[model samples]
Target: MSEVVLITGGSSGIGKSIGELLTTKGFKVYGTSRNPEKYKDSLFPILALDVRDLNTIQQTVKTIIEKENRLDVLINNAGAGITGPIEEIPEAEIKANFETNFFGPINVIKSVLPQMRKQRSGLIINITSIAGYMGLPYRGIYSASKGALELITEAFRMELKDFNIKMTNVAPGDFATNIAAGRYHAPILNDSPYQKPYGNTLKLMDAHVDKGSPPNLMAEAIFNIINSKNPKIHYKVGNFMQRFSIVLKRILPDKLYEKLLINHYKL
Candidate 1:
C-alpha cells in the first residue's frame, strides 16, 4: 500500500505544490484547507481543516486514519504572517498570529502523534521560515512565532526518536505564495513614529518574497526528506544567499549579525 500523507494549508502555495508532487510520486495525499470544497478539482483529496481549531484537527485526523488505515507523514504547512513594528502591534493580533503559526501546528501534531506512535514510524515536517532564526525589524511577531515552532520541533525530535518518528523543521527564506494576501497587518497609528521605517521595511520584505524560489524546489526537497531513511533535523530551502544567511548567523558575532539584517532590510 502507498504511504498516506497529510498536509495542512494545502489548497495553495507550497502546500499545494507538495501535495501534487507527492500524488504523482504514488503517495496517497490529502491536503487540508479551511474551505476544502473550493479545491475540489485538485489532484489530491482536500479535507476541511482549520488548524487553530482542535476539534477540527481531531476530526480530520480521525477521518484520515479511518479511511487510509495509516498515516505515514504529516506536513504542518499552515501558517499566518503578521507584520508591523513590535510596539505598534496589538496584543490581540499577536495572540491571533501565534494561534495560527505556532499553536495551530502544535494541535495538529498532538492529534496525529498517538496514531504515529502506534504505527511505530512516521515523519512530521513543520514549515517554519528563515526569519525564525532571527528577528526581522517589522516582522518581529512573525519571527517569534516561527522561532517558537522551530524550537518546539527540535525538542520533539529528541522526544519522538524513541518512537521511531522523525521530525524536521523546514525553514524557507521566502516563497511566492498567497501568504501575503492572508497576512495580518497590525494597526499602525497615523502619528506613530515608526510608520515610515515600517513601511520601507514591509516593502522590502514583499519584494524579497516576490523574488523567492519556485515552490517546486520546496516540493522536491520535502519528497527527498520523506523518502530518506535518515533525514536531517533541519532543512533550509531557498536561494544561496538566503540559505547562507543561516550559516552566517551561526558563525557571525551577535552585533555583526544584527548589522547584516539591518542593512539587508534597510532598517
Candidate 2:
C-alpha cells in the first residue's frame, strides 16, 4: 500500500507544491487549509484545518487516521511571516506570529504523535526557515519563531527515537511564494527611529522573495527525505549563499558575522 501523508498549509505555496509532487509519486497525500472550499481542484484532498485551533488540529488528524488506518508521514508546513523592527512591532502581533509559526506546529505534532506511535512507523518534517538560523534586523520576530521550532525538532527527534518515529527540520531560504502578501508588516512610522533602515530593509526583503528560487526546490528536497532509510535530523534547501550563511555564522566571530549582515542589509 502507498504511504499516507498529511501536509499542513497545503493550499498553496511550498505546501501545495510538495503535495502535488508527492501525489504524482503515488503517495496518498492529504493537504490542509483553513478553508478547504477554495481549492476545489487541488491534486490531492484539501481538508479544513487551522493549525492554531487545537480542536481542528485534533479533528483533522483523527479524520486522516480513520480513513488511512496508518498515518505514515506528516509535514508541519503551516507558518506565517512577520517583518518589522523588533522594537516597533506590537507585542500582540509578535505573540500571534509565534502562535502560528511555533506553537501551532507543536500542537499539530502532538495531535499526530499518538497515531504515529500506534503505527510504530512514521516521519514528521517541520518546515522552518533559513532566517531562523540568525536574527535579521527587521525580521527578528519571524526568525525567533521559526528558530524556536527548529530547536524543538531537535529535542523531539531524540524523544521519539525509541518509538521508531523520526522527526526533522527542513529550513528553506526565500522562495517565490505568496508568503509576502500574507506576512504582517508593521507599518513604517514616519517619526520612528528605525524608519529609514527598516524601510530599506523591507524593500530588499521583498526583492529577495520576488527573485527567490522556485517552491519546487523545497518540494523535491522533502520528497527525498521521505524516501531515505534514515533521514538526517536537519536539512536545508536554498541557494549557495543562503545555505552558506549558516556556515558563516558558525565559523566567523560574532561581531564579524554581525558586520556582514549589517553590510548586506545596509543597516
Per-prediction TM-score = 0.98, 0.99
Q: Candidate 1: minimum summed lDDT over ten consecutive residues — where?
A: 181-190
Q: Least lDDT summed over 10 consecutive residues: which range in candidate 2?
A: 112-121
Question: lDDT (CA) for every model shown?
Answer: 0.92, 0.96
Instruction: Supply the TM-score for candidate 2.
Output: 0.99
Model 1, residue pairs in steric clash: none
Model 1 Cα lDDT, one tens digit per residue, 23-78: 99999999999999898799999999998799999999999999988999999999
Cα RMSD to the true fold for all candidates: 1.0, 0.6
**RMSD (Cα, Å) of candidate 2?**
0.6
Please, what are the lDDT tens digits per residue for candidate 2 over residues 53-89? 9999999999998998989999999999999988888
